[model samples]
Target: MVRRLPFLLGGIALFLVNALTLSIGFGFGLSGVPAALLIAAPVVLCWYRPMAAWWLALAGLLLLTLLGPVLSDDEALQYRPWLLNAIPAHLAVVYVLALSVRLRIAIPAFVIYLAAGALTPIHLLDDLPNAIAGAIVWAMAVLVAMVLGHNKRVRLTSTLRIAEERGRRLVLEERNRIARELHDMVAHHMSVIAVQTATARYRLPGGVSEEASREFQAINATARESLREMRHLLGVLRDPADPAETEPPPQGLADLPRLMESARRAGTPVRLAVVDTPDPLSPAAALTAYRIVQEALSNVVRHATGAATRVEVAPDETCSALIVEVHNAPPDAPPPAVERPHPGHGLVGMRERVAVHGGDMTAAPTPEGGFIVRATLPLASSTGAGEPSPDVMDGGDGRDTSDDQRIDRR
Candidate 1:
């Protein structure tokens, strides 16, 4: 609306010209057409190039003031030098200029506008009274435009700053969460290494030589140091504002139904089907799978709210990788609000997670004006895991037939 405001004002200026020119009275004849375009051109241009628009506005006004009397077929307006219609167009241009540029720039442009307005009325046909009214009106328009434009710009700047800071905070939080998870895994391994190295000399059935014992001591020391550094790094990554010292339990495939149900409660029609893996996936892979599904569903809820969403998690034909696909059908009704600011991964971090396990993902819009996210996370890490049992999984509001097993809800 802000961008188009200038254009609308420009259109109003043109409409005024057209309405006046078509009336049963003297007009600028055919010359008024060019003059109207000239007057409105700046306003239309303001949205794209404010400085240039300001210049065009000034030039148009000058041309009209200098030539309006000669070109007018009407005697009363011949010596007017300026028309009231120019006021709104000028205001539109100035408002956009102040809103888009810096205060210093806007102030100088405004002063130029004021100087021209103050001087233009010097040769008015109605002399002092009309000139005084025109000057007063022009001053008020400039004042309003300057004040509102600057306020709008300031508010917009503040909003953008807040958004940027919020994004940075989210990134930091994600880093801390990942760091804690890494610390959990790496710390355990480091502890084992330290214990084994410390006991190596004595644990051997045959006692080790002094030199070998010294090397074992060195190895144990290095492992302990590394463990210490790792802990320190985790501490640094952890958010100080977070009160919890322990990590949250990681999400897995079992958590997906709950995630979908949550989406259902929020007005998104969602269905979930998970083909049970013959062999249970590793924690990391399971978590990856859960997050992939979670992110896709969240995006559907955010960007395509009220859409009928289907989620299918199964092993691929080769039975070597798990395939997760989320398809959102067209919504039956308009969304409650313009889609909210969707910071959720449509498939972003999900892609990186899948890639870590040597898998692939794809997300795109459906032909029916919906969206689909598909991913293949290799199940080779878990043997005999690819094949999915025929099971119906209930996500939200419907059920589907399956050869092996199925969970359906409607």
Candidate 2:
């Protein structure tokens, strides 16, 4: 109420003054038509629209001009040619000011209205000064309307952008919270299950059935492996700048042979071959390549029991790309399909890894009863020839002398 006190008092004051002026029937201090429009235009624009306010202005003009003489019983002013001319002219100016709010009016329209209104008193009442005063009043109205319209548009746009940014930040925070919960649950439960299974197996004596022993041993082994994979997934989500972290293993073309050997131990025969691997890939490129193979082989172990797998890692000189392809073919009799489904996270993560360095990947099943996963990682210079030449990955040569398993956590 305090903020609006000044406006409320000013409006009541203006109404009293306008009424007194009309009642006295003295010559209008500035022309009665323009004075009323100047006071009412903004209030109407705020509460209503350009067209409705324009109609109101028109009706008001008619009442003020036509009824003034009737109320005052003054024939001298009512039929006066100058008063008649000025009345409609002022109404036309009000209509233009209202229309300007709804459209982008050209400068010519305002100029023409001012030019014609400037001659009203001169032609009708032989008074040039009054005509000039009326022209000045109309010009100021157009200026105020343009400023309000521009300010309103800018304020609305800024408010919308701020709201959109706040919404995006909320969504990102929620997703991070959910991911943390998933990691903690998987790690704790799988670790506990593996430990209990191993304890149960050791307590059993030779008198126990062979089937029971085998079942306990397999369960223990599988659960332990699952726990390791879960830990790796959690580590990937860690912020890189933390001081307590250790570097993860270096995974690139050279690791393919060892990965295949690990699969062979699990009773899945794997053939590994490497070509054009004399030069090591960049760290990002290497990690993406490793994940592609890891996800594919992990799928094979879970879904294609007793399957034969082969991995091919080759470099295409023409394209400057490291091509990795992993294929798996199960026995003639299809292995019982385990309902284990890929969560799409592993595949989506692989693609995100490749996309960071602008590479491509594809995953699909072959018609020959096998699944295939392939990726082509580009190994261009990290700096793209735009910076000072960088030192090679290991000294000046392509060979990386650092321990292959050592990861640079810092």
Candidate 3:
């Protein structure tokens, strides 16, 4: 009700102003009460029905002009040009028509208004200038209203387009982030499993059972198949603008030693340790472990360079899972100057990686004014033959690898 108050007040004001002009015709006794009512009907009806109001106003003006000589008394001839009084009401109606209707209706109504001015016979010789001036004013008002309405529509369309583009950009950014996390957490592990199984099978100790050797071969074959499928999946996820040939392989636990050496050369001292275990980690678990340590050390290098950092990788003694922790001491000096702001998607990516493996992770400030990140990834179960399940092979698909096809020919 409160929101509607302004419209109500505006409609009442329009009716009263049109009523005032109609009252002049009544005072001159040019037409009786009935004709006066007809002239005022459109003004009152315009609030409820604009199109009908336009027709009604035009008809009433024409009716009054045709009947003018008959309705006026001899004394009223002194004010013979009674149609002049209706000029304001007619202009108001034209303005409303242009504002509320489409161009087809509005343009015709304007044309009719000019036609009425020229055809109405009630105009005296002295009233010609006033009639011409009134028509000019009405045309200007209608044109201004149409121009404003067009501009408002264009602005509204432009604003909606901008909002839609912003939404599309946000969706693309989210897809790219998911692709990055998959590359870091899944591809890395698959690469490691393929490399390790191939090397371990040939390096087996003497007198190993033939069945054991077969199982190792099967595991090696499955890992390699999974790696090929992973590459295809990555290709699908990668942006089309990125060249596949230029893309590098994912890094894993095997890359830790080189990463540590590079950090040391960059002036950040670090220590690395891995606990021995008889059973190796699943590809997903190993990749999750590697990413956690990688992101943690990256944080240290960016925010706490020159700090002493320790990276620990080991199997959890209490459960069939791998535990990874990266702890760093406070920086000896302030961080180096940076060229751009960090978007801070690193921690989010770590959590996503851990969650994918049904693992838990935490990154928080330690009591010693340093930062520590810890993650535990539960190892997936293997088949009785010591191989990952067929579903795990090729990452839940039976897609044959081109590499395996080439190997078979060899």
Candidate 4:
């Protein structure tokens, strides 16, 4: 009903004007032409160009004003003043025409109705009813113009909002693409760097200075750690079932032995406990578990340097799930201040991996001291081995057997 209101009002106004002219014995075209122009202003402003429509309305108003005097009765010419009303009507028409274009009003063409109202008193001469009707018509015309201006502003706002949303989506997609490429390229280089460092550290002669050996060892450790971190980040970028694009190596619970051995080499105490030993895990689940443990140990090394840490891995026979946890004492005073949140990336990557598999992970500052990371991974089968278990130290607890200080339970 609201949609058809403008058309209904316009049709009634035209009918009234036509009936008045017909009853008064005026020419049909003379009254009907101006009434039609007033009716059309509302509809034309809705779709037509503001400037063009306003200019056309101005031209029509000028022609109508001139035609009005030439064709109308020289009604009791002494008492009647036609030009006073005609001039203001003409000026009002011109003012509104330009204002419609500048303000982007919807009723660009109909504004001439206001001019017609102003001129009505000139012809009616002290007729109270017609004067009151003319005033009402002018008020309605201004009201319509205000509505149109508001509507135009709303439409522009909606269009701008849609454009902004599209731009933001495009930016997010580009960032994901760049992150994938960087992960693959950087991981490959870091792996190679690690291998070369290990070779140099082993083959270097006794004549080599202690400073040189220490530098080589530091580079080797740093490169290997960087490679692991890159692979974890790459895992976050991998889409589901994208075979053409292979994921970074699968790291899981099986990787714990190697993790402990590395920590032992760095002279850090790490205890491990493996409870229910079940068959190997699914590739995806295995990789998730591996990353959780890897990131947990990495955090301990970076934040709790020289602090004692314990790792516990248990398989719930009833639930067919694996639980792995890492806990350590807090650093001496204020935690080893990170230059940035780079170290937090490992924990974030771990959480992302676990969530994909409908698994759960928790990492936060411990109430006692230090930080703790605990993760639960679901297993498919118990009796049958799905994937080959990587070579594990298989000491009492997957920890290195050499000393009680470090252990690897596989």
In terms of TM-score, which candidate is strongest?
A: 1
Q: What are the clash counts of all predictions, listed in order?
A: 13, 0, 0, 12
- Give the Cα-based TM-score of candidate 3 against the true structure: 0.40
Candidate that would win on lDDT: 1
Error of 3 at 38 (Å): 62
Judged by whole-model lDDT over C-alpha atoms, candidate 4 comes out at 0.54
Q: What is the lDDT of residue 273 in candidate 1?
A: 79
Model 3, 1-410: lDDT tens per residue? 01334434544554454355434633434335556556556656665676898888777767666665455554234222224444445545565566566677677777776666555433545566764665566556555655564455456567889968865664554456456656656667867877776677566667347787677678889988887887787667777874444435334676667556655665677878766532555645665676666667667776777888888886665547777888899888888765533233456567777877788988888999988889888777422233222111000111111110111000
Q: Write the per-residue lDDT of candidate 2 for residues 302-395, one digit (tens) a residue.
A: 5664577777776665536777788888555654643423122345455555665677888777888787878888877332222222121110
User: Which sections of candidate 2 miss by over 4 Å?
Assistant: 1-10, 25-133, 197-200, 203-410
lDDT of 1 by residue, 218-247 (tens): 989999999999988887887677667453
User: Per-residue error at 399 for model 3, in Å?
Assistant: 39
- Give the deviation of candidate 2 from the true structure as CA RMSD: 22.1
CA RMSD per model (angstroms): 7.1, 22.1, 16.2, 19.4
Worst 10 residues of 2 by lDDT: 392-401
User: What is the model-wide C-alpha lDDT for candidate 3?
Assistant: 0.60
Please give the ranking of all candidate structures by lDDT, highest first, separated by commas: 1, 3, 4, 2
lDDT of model 4, residue 217: 77
